[model samples]
Target: MKDQGLSYRLTAGLEGYLDPADALVTALAHGGGADNERCLKRVTAHLKADVKEVSAFLGLVRIRELPRREDIELRNTAFLHELGPSLTGAEITGLYTELVRRTREAMQGRLGPRWAEQLAVHDLPTKLLRKRIGPSTVADLQQRLLRPDHVLLTDVSQRLSGVETALVRKLRRGAATDDVIQEAQMVRAHADIHRMKQQSLGTWPADPAIEADLDERLLLVARRTIRSHATDPRPANAIFDGLQTTLETSAATHDRWPLYARDSVLLMGRACAISDECRFDWGTAHESPA
Candidate 1:
């Protein structure tokens, strides 16, 4: 059930920023090569992102690019709010210290304390470990999605395997030539369109023709988005930047260690192992569950 819940969230998050069919196509289109790098390159998020922008933004690349010129103060305040609602100073320090110490020890033979300290300056928790992930995260994600240079190389690695699987399915079923074309069209149509990013258009899709046009637009939108990020990736980059971002500041003030997470979450219905002796010891000590 927890797996299903995570799966459900994943599906929702994908739809929120990705074009499903186009992503599949991109995955199919870019998954394989003589070299076999990543699903796509540019959109991939290599650092501390909850959503991997590199291979993931593949389907939504076709949207119109609107320049964002927001007021600096308002934008800064919002960013802080979004990222500030999790973790505490001390806990952040603890995690950072542990991560750095472990990393240094692991690499001591190769790089020594000097290089390790340099690396430690950037060590922080990955996106998955954070207590808060929201619009600020999304905004950062959008940066990678839009830029050819901002990709996370490692994020696309996992998708290569999936692409192989998807390609087989498509080829086996004899899927049509128009299918990829249709998907591409969808990607281009809305690859960059956003309701929130608008300058306020009233009743924008004003005609029946436009309504139908929107439906037809889906495939192109998929193409534009996917193609931009169409590079296979490495897997370790997201955590790297995520950890580094934390060094700039502590975890959000609201950050609390969750009871469950991908790496450390305790699952539902795992039996607590309390032996009779332990129970008797606890009773003798007059200890209660804290």
Candidate 2:
């Protein structure tokens, strides 16, 4: 069974490598004439190099596979210690930066206009750099990002929904005060509305009227939630004050709301958790809830 599992994994990995490899080879063949001996030699060299790298990577994987299950931390520590003498942090960072640059170049070369459209849609280059993914994986990822299917959209939507639902449930059950719950809900609503606006950007002929309505509704929720919790003496009231200040100071169309809303939610959540912890600690230490 273990051997079969390994076989399946190896086959899947090869399949991933093969598709891109085939496309690249075909591109080279088409770009260079079929009768070009130089192109043929280049293709042969490329394949051989790829095979050698894959074999070496697999060998390392197999060597690490058993020890990984036994004591991953110890194995990782030993591996890092071995590299400590030779591999400086600056070297690692330089290598990573070069990888990202090469990946960007490859995407720009292959994807062209589609790649530009993606950049206009989001800060994709920054995201790629942040992820620090390998150049070899970029082709597959670029295809998916450029042409996301219904399944991908549905999966992402479901995952986001799942996360929001879990957070709401926890906030309701765990919050020590109604004020905390209300403030958290306000932040959550803002985040949801911001996400909806971002999603609308992908749609052609987006209805500005509908978006305006959402914006108004979000503002109303924020104002109402803040008003209700204004007199509350909790530490989370500071979060509400910040939100109120932002609402008053910022222009209605400013792009700062999304980030502000996200930060507010996180801050409020942390404040609530700390407040609950403090109450618990006070109760336990002094036999009275603060």
Candidate 3:
């Protein structure tokens, strides 16, 4: 199992080098006599696309784009040569077939027929060096839980959802002063614009830690509202109303957010749900017969 795993890792690392090499080679093969220059130029452009696609795939698979060590390549070559011949031809073909499919899909709707022809790749010898390796179970799960592979996701989610809590706290301390209200308004406006920027940059799927923190904060705010305004239910009700409003607006705005920001919207939904549930529980407890 360990040897098989190492083989897979070696193949994954080799894939980046072989991807563009194979594209250029295939184009050269078709170049033949007359169209060599034109084919080379076309292949050059195709190579750029190939590099981009391959880089994205590598990132997705969490493999380094380029390894600095020289001996690694030699070792990989020796290992593959030693191991390649014994492997059945069918296994080799299946590997390349899957690679092509994955490459096209990773391009994310950009892989058209022209691109398919320009790359013009088929089963190559190096295809045996192409293997799909994924992170360990814990690492993979961690990645899925986090926000779009960014550390700032936690801060952003907190900042965005903090608006309502900030407002409630300000109101609870005393009457809703102009300065307090203005501060809350400013925070909300800033959060809205920040969200739009994140959407534009395709930074969807907020980190789970960030979302979890926001949910807890929102719930805390709801509980505080109940405690702080036991005599006047209006403020607590308003806080719940604000949570609902934010949730609805966030969902509607997601239609305009980038494809990558889909996870962020879900985070918003989860945060709102926590707030809503907290509010409902408070209301039910207050109304219970004594």
Candidate 2 structure, TM-score to reference:
0.20
lDDT (tens digit, per residue) of candidate 1 on 1-290? 55676421121112223333444533443432112245344233343443444334333333322323332222332222223324344443444455445445544444434654545555533421243345563464344233453334342334444422222222122222444323323322332232222213353344546324432232233233334322313111221122223322422211122111111101100000111001100011112345
- What are the clashing pairs of model 2? none
Q: Which digits, one per residue and each the tens of the lDDT, describe model 3 over residues 1-290?
A: 54676422221333222133345433333332123455435544656766444433333232224432332333332222223334344543444445446655544544344554535556422332233233441353233334353343233344443333423333433344455345444444444444445555677456656545555554655465455555543444454445445545554343232322434434334443343222223232123235
Predictions in order: lDDT = 0.29, 0.39, 0.40
The stretch of ten residues in a row with the least summed lDDT in candidate 2 is: 278-287
**Model 2 regions lying over 4 Å from their true place:** 1-176, 200-233, 251-290
Per-residue lDDT of model 2, residues 18-63, tens digit only? 1223444433323322234564456447666564444333332211
Ranking of models by lDDT: 3, 2, 1
Best by lDDT: 3
Each prediction's TM-score versus the true structure: 0.15, 0.20, 0.21
Query: Which pairs clash (backbone N, Cα, C closer than 3 Å) in model 3?
Result: 146-207, 147-206, 147-207, 204-260, 204-261, 205-264
